[model samples]
Target: MELTDTINQVVNLTKDEKLSIEKYFTVKTLPKGGLWIKEGQYCNHIAFIKKGICRIFYNDQDGNEISCFFMPENNFISSYTSFLTLTPTKENIEAVEDLEMLVINREDLEKLSKEVPKVQIWRRVIAENLFILLERRISMLQSKTAQERYENLIKENGDILLKVPLQYTASFLGVTPQHLSRLRKNSVK
Candidate 1:
């Protein structure tokens, strides 16, 4: 799908509003495993995935990489807290597959929001969606069992198995790889 179409699907923009958004977006590509943003660095841009998948992760206290989230095609990916606050990111973003992205810089987004009132509305919609997703994630982590979480993931994002590595998916689900394997085996039976 075209970038404009993707943006409109996310924000419900009018033709003129889409044209304005297009002015801020720049197309870019990254190879698999490429780091789009790193921990401790400022995130100056937000990426809208056009193709392929990206993972947001960070090194844990034990120096193990823990996957936080995945962004598939047509999804928005960013270190949102860092981007909003202009502070160092605690998360790292990397391409899981060769990726095509439409990126917009923070400065450009701010300028657009000021110039187009609709852009502010779009920003709020995006923020609200992110907030809801985060809340759901927190609840899942706090109350769901490993098997329940795995089942919920399969139900909500069946396509993720095809897009993300098993180990990464296990990490994102907050379980050991062995536990995930056992859970999957049990589900199949």
Candidate 2:
């Protein structure tokens, strides 16, 4: 998947603007279980997944990992709070499977937006989508029962069974693994 193809999916850009934006992208591959960014390190680049899966997770005071979100093929991955504020990340981004991605440094992204106006539109669209997802996630946690959340997850991301481990899925849904197992079994019946 080319940079132009990904950008086009998110926002419309002129041919020239697309060409300039592409120049800033560097393609990289990560092995399964690779740690891309560790806690307390600044995330200097934003990654666009072309293949495989990655996840953003944080550790709780009890030293247990809490799964925040998963980034699958054709999705964008970043520690947004740290990236925007240029602060140390509180979360870790790890590759769940061998991954291919196109990355752009924060500085280069800023330069590209100034050089090519359309890139700004692309950035705004991406930010808006991120905000919407965050809002929906919060709502799901606050308003939905564990069973409802699990059902909604199955409805929205049916392929999750193929892509993610059950334990990780349980963590993402804010439930114990046994609870998720029961939910899954009940839903299947």
Candidate 3:
């Protein structure tokens, strides 16, 4: 969905407000396997995925890149902590597939909020939704078994395995790739 449409879905925007908001976003793309935000980079922009998928991951002490979240088309992707605090990101966001997005940098977003005060409501709603999602992720990781997590992933995103690699999906589920293969085989039976 378009940015204006997404904003309207969250909070009703006047015609002028919609036009004003659109100008803040610019089109961007990243090829598959490209890093959108590398670790230690400041993520100053929040982008809406127009197409494709990306995974947000971080390197463990052992230097394993473990994916924690996936962003699919029509959704927003950002390192919320870095974007808000103006600090370096602890994670990398990589395009799992060729990506197309509309991004608004922090400065323009601030200007947009000032220009269209109601944009604040939209921003708050987006942040709240992101918070809820992160909370669910933490709860799942803390309480769920690997098999249960795999099932939940399947239930939530049926085509995700097709889109993301097995290794990444396995890491996200707190399982080995071999174990994930077994889970998939069992799920099919």
Top of the candidates by lDDT: 3
Candidate 3 per-residue lDDT over residues 22-131, each given as its tens digit? 89899999999999899999999999999999999999999998989998998888999999999999999999999999999999999999999998998899889989
Model 3 scores worst on lDDT over the 10 consecutive residues at: 1-10
Clashing pairs in 3: none
| lDDT on C-alpha atoms for all candidate structures | 0.88, 0.88, 0.92
Best by TM-score: 3
Each candidate structure's TM-score, on Cα atoms with residue i matched to residue i, is 0.94, 0.95, 0.97
Tens digit of per-residue lDDT, candidate 1, span 10-127: 5677788878888889999999999999999999998889999999999999988998888789888899999999899999999999999999998898898886677776678889
Q: Local error of candidate 3 at 125, Å?
A: 1.2
RMSD for all candidates, in order, please.
1.4, 1.3, 0.9
What lDDT would candidate 2 get against the real structure?
Answer: 0.88
- Minimum summed lDDT over a 10-residue window in model 1 is located at 2-11
lDDT of 3: 0.92
Predicted candidate 3, C-alpha RMSD: 0.9
- lDDT for 20 (candidate 3): 94
Q: What's the TM for model 2?
A: 0.95
Give one digit per residue, the lDDT tens place, for model 2 in 22-131: 78889999999899999999988998898889988999999888998888888888888888899999999998899999999998988988998777878888889999
